[model samples]
Each structure stands twice: as C-alpha cells, then as structure tokens.
Target: MNKTENSRRRGDELLESLYNATMKLATTTKLTNLTFQQIADEARTSRTVLYRRWSTPFDLLQDIYSYKAKKLFDGAFFDELKDNGSLRKDLLQLLTVYQKVHTEIGAEIINNYYFLRAQDKNDNNELLIHKQAVEKHLNATKKILANAEKRGEKIRKISPITLMLPYDLIRTENLIRPTNISKKRLTMMVDEILMPVFVG
Candidate 1:
C-alpha cells in the first residue's frame, strides 16, 4: 500500500482500539473508578498514547459518550425518522429511543460526571466537556425536528428549552413504574400535553 493509505489505515486502527477500550470501560467500570491508565491497559496501549490524543480522562470519556450516542441514534432513531414519514410517528420513535438511552446509559453517565465535577470545583474542563457532549445530542434532535417542520408538519410551538421535557420526565421516573410506554401513548402525550403549547 502507498504511504498515505498505510497512514490512514493506522489512524483507523487506533480509533477502533480506542473506541473498543472505551466501550469496555463504560460497561464494566463505574465512572468514579474509570482511569486513563485502566483504559490504556485495557486497550493494550500505553498511557502516553491516550494522553497524546486526549487531554484528560474526561476528554476520553466524553469522546466515548459521543460515539455511543451517535451510534445508537444513527442505528435506530435516524433510520426510523427517515422511514416513518409522518411527523407524529417520527417524533414518537425519537422519544422512545431518547427515553431508552437517557434512562439506560446516557443519563447515568452524565449524572455521575455532573455530581463528580460538582464536588471537584477545580474541574471546570470536565464540566465543560460534559456540557458540550450533551448539547451536541440535543442539537441533533432539534435538527430532526427542524426537518419535520420543513416537511410541512406541525411542530408544537413550545419553547425550544421544553423540547427535552418528555425525556427528562421519563428519566426522572415520573411515569408509572414497571410499565412500558407504548408508542401510541407517547404520541398522545405529545399531542395533548406538548402540542397545544408548541404547535398552537
């Protein structure tokens, strides 16, 4: 292979290794116990390599969260949005995926990091990284909503800030316990609770 091709392949390999190591760390270790050294050892690389690519453990963790969130949304949410056609159907699918990720992985990691950073007042960079990662996910959802708007679908006229309420409510366990929310119920909630405020 040419030198340029070899260099690209090496870069891809490094990213794959890093991603695999991060996934292992996310699933296996509590956020409090995850360390750069642990990740490096798990990936079969050295601390220096990780440090060369990421400024701190938080940076590495942020990259991992971003990667996982993107993968989940791309695999299910985006695909459903593209195929579902109707705005209501797309929004319901989006909400289901959003709730699952928030309650399952995203909220746990983010809440842990937020609590940790709050206790460590000196860790401004960690807080900023976490905030940015969250904003990126939120912005992607907004873009999807915007696309719906472009398609002549009526989006609720609620404040953009309130767009996160449904997921936040689910994450906070406001709904009945041990009950799976049906797509029809989600659609009804959006239409009844959010639509009058957002779409009207």
Candidate 2:
C-alpha cells in the first residue's frame, strides 16, 4: 500500500484499539473513574498518543458514547436481526445481546449518558438523540411484527406501549438486581410474557 493508505489503516487500528479498551473499562468502572492513563494502559499504548489526539477524557468519551449508541441498536445489530426468519428467534437474539451488555457495562453506560445529558438540559440535543435511537429500535420491532403477520403467525394487535413492555420489564429488573438477566429468564419472558401478549 502507499503511504496515505498505510496511514489511514494505522489510524483505524489505533481508534479500534482505544475503543475496545474504553468499552472493557466501562464494564468495570464508573465514567468518573475513567482517565487517559487508565485507557492508555488498557489499550496498551502511550499516554502521549492519547493526549495528542484528545484534549480531555470527555472528548474521547463523547466519541465512545456515540459509538455505543450506534453499536447497540443500529449497524450490525439490526443486520443480524433482519436475517432471523422467526420473530421468536429475533426477540431472543436482541435480548441475548442486550443482556450481555447489561451484565458488562450497563450501569456505566447509563450513568455516562445521563450525566452528560443532565449537564446540558438547555441544549436538548442529548434528549433528541436518545429519542431518535428509541424510534429506530421501535421501527425495527414494528417491521419484525409486520413480517410475522405476513407469514400468518398468530399475532394479536399490539400497541406501542405493549411493544415496549419486554424492555421496560428488563430495565426494571436490572434496576433491582444490576446483573445479567439469565438466558432462561429471558426465554421465559419471551415465551410467557411477551409472546402471550403478541399472540393472544
């Protein structure tokens, strides 16, 4: 490769390494505990490189926050969902991934996003961004249900609130337990609670 191509590839690799380190650290500590030194150590890099690229931890954090948002519900997550032919399988896929995220870094991610959002109440950009993310997920869910209907699955009419019930229930449980909701429990939720509502 030429110099420019090599330089671009190196830059991408650096960012990926930093991002992986940020996510791993996020699982173990609060956002307030994150530091350039810690991230550098986790990424196995020099602090000087981080300092040269990012003026403050918060700048790096903003990039992480945006990345986490896109990673969670957009991009490859949705691509995998679209390939699942069964609604039940689709629900399982989404929830299984979500549970893993909750178990790993749910609290830190929540705290970081809300803390930054709270810091800018007058701006409202944070709220708008969050709302847009939710809408995108909801639209994906709607398409899943629509596909099920097309396949002649026995599904009842569902309201928006009912469609959100599974996640709301999971979030509530997380607030109480702050751990990964087990696969068995998630399956029970889909089969017993969420599926009943959709099919009956």
Candidate 3:
C-alpha cells in the first residue's frame, strides 16, 4: 500500500486500540476511578495523542461506547434476526443476547456512567450521548417488532420503558448476587408480560 494509505490504516488502528482500552477500563473500574494516564498506558499510546483525539475523558468514553455498541449489535445480532424470519424467535434471541451482555460487562459501564453523571450535573453531555445511543438501539428493536406486526405476525406491544424494565431488573439482581434465570424464563416473561401489551 502507499505511504498515505498505510498512515491512514495506522491511525485507524490506533483509534481502535484506544477505544478498546477505554472500554476495558470502563468495564473493570468505575468512571471516577479511570484516569487518562491509565488509558494511555493501557492503549500503549501517549496522553498527548489521546488528548488530541478527545478533549475529555467523557469524549473518549462516548467514542468507546459507540464503537462497542456497533461491534456488538449491528453485525451478528441483526444478521441473525433477519435470517431467523420468525419475529418472536428473533426478539427472544435479541433479548437473550442483551441480557447476557448487560449482566456480563455492559451493565457496569452503564451504571458507572450514570453514577458519574449524577455526581456532576454539568457532565450532561456524556450522559446525553449515552442515552441517545440507548434510545437508538431501542428504536431499532421496536422497528423490527413493528415490521413483524405488519407481516400479520402476533407480537405483544412493548413500550420502551417496559422492554427495559426487566433488563434493569436482571442486571440489578445479577449485580447483587448472580442468579440462574434461564433464557427460557426471560423469553416466557417477554411473551407473557410484554406481548400482551404490544401485540393487541
């Protein structure tokens, strides 16, 4: 490849590395516990490079979440849903993946972000950006369900609030003490509680 092309690839790789480091820190430590120095060290890049790219830690976090969400949801999850061709099955799969990820790592970052945002009212931008990303994900999921409804398929009507409630509950329970809630149980809950309101 040309020098310019190689340079561009290198820059992209650097950004990816920085983002991965930030996400690792986010999942493993509280937001308040994270430092630019730590991120720089973890990414194998200098603080100057990170600062030039992101003005603040929040900006770095915003980019990290955007990258992680895209990596997690857009590719395999969406593809599997499209291929399944069964609305209920697809929704269940989506929820199952979400539940697993949230319980595993995503929930910690999400909670930490909220906790930090609460401590500083001036730090609304990071929280807003994170909230918007979440809303977009929910809207996309809703659109999928809407399409299924249009196809004459039966699905329970689900408000964004209702959809997120059980997820929050599961995350909280897991955080307190790991639970053995099966995917089947979650699927049943969605079918029984959410479907009734969403479908009719």
Report the Cα RMSD per candidate: 7.4, 6.2, 6.2
Give the per-residue lDDT of model 3 (tens digit) for 1-200.
33333324456787887777787877677776788888877776677777777887877776665565553433343444452566666666666766666654565555554555566677655534455556656665676677777788876655677655534555554556455567767778568755565565
lDDT of 2 by residue, 64-158 (tens): 67766655544345655553777787777766666665555556665566566666668634534556657766776787788888877877887
Flag regions of model 1 displaced more than 4 Å: 1-9, 71-157, 163-181, 196-200
Rank by TM-score, descending? 2, 3, 1
Q: Which consecutive 10 residues in model 2 have the weakest lDDT in total? A: 1-10
Off by over 4 Å in 3: 1-9, 23-29, 71-76, 82-91, 97-181
- Give the per-residue Cα lDDT of candidate 2 at 22: 80
RMSD of candidate 3 to true structure, Å: 6.2
Task: Report the poorest 10 consecutive residues by lDDT, candidate 3.
Answer: 1-10
> Looking at candidate 2, what is the lDDT of residue 93?
71
> What lDDT does each candidate get?
0.60, 0.69, 0.63
Better of 1 and 3 by TM-score: 3
Error in Å for residue 182 of model 1: 3.9
- Largest lDDT belongs to which candidate? 2
Clashes per candidate (backbone, < 3 Å): 5, 0, 6
The TM-score, computed over Cα atoms with residue i paired to residue i, of candidate 1 is 0.53
